[model samples]
Target: MNDHDLLETYEPVLRFAKSERFFPMAVEHYLERCSILPSGPLGAAGLLFHLNEPLATFIGKLEGGQYFLRFINEPLYDADA
Candidate 1:
């Protein structure tokens, strides 16, 4: 999936989070961090790798709490990093 597709897929969830007045903050925070990285332009795969952990953490926090967010999930795919 390309960046556009990735965003499209997550846009609804993001919108939902915004509707609930959450997640958007976390998403913005993650974007801030990602922007600093010199990863150049990346698409869906790039985002999945770079953000899987952070996004999962954010989601977990929203769902249950920091404690509930598992850091032991399968590794994400990072392209030629």
Candidate 2:
């Protein structure tokens, strides 16, 4: 799945106190990193930092990293799931 698709995948669950737009920003960061290191493995922490303060707290920095790690590495990953 491409980085843009992450928006659609998380749109329903994505939450933000400041602005919903921050979510897309985070997704863009993730996508950018992926493009730079397509073959290299990724962690959510890399993308999570792009999020604003409230959004970062909502997801929990380290926890967010774990989530991305699992989703990216899992055989059958589903953002909605």
The best candidate in terms of lDDT: 2
Backbone clashes in model 1, listed as residue pairs: none
lDDT of 2 by residue, 1-81 (tens): 888898778766646787453345465345433322122235444544545443323433333233432123334436657
Q: How far is candidate 2 from the true structure (C-alpha RMSD, Å)?
A: 15.6
Q: Kindly give the number of clashing pairs for every candidate.
A: 0, 0
Off by over 4 Å in 1: 12-81
Where does candidate 1 have its weakest 10-residue lDDT segment?
63-72
Model 2: which residue pairs collide?
none
TM-score of each: 0.16, 0.15
Per-residue CA lDDT of model 1 for 1-81, tens digit only, reads: 999999888886423643573344465555434422222343322444445465534333332121212122343446735
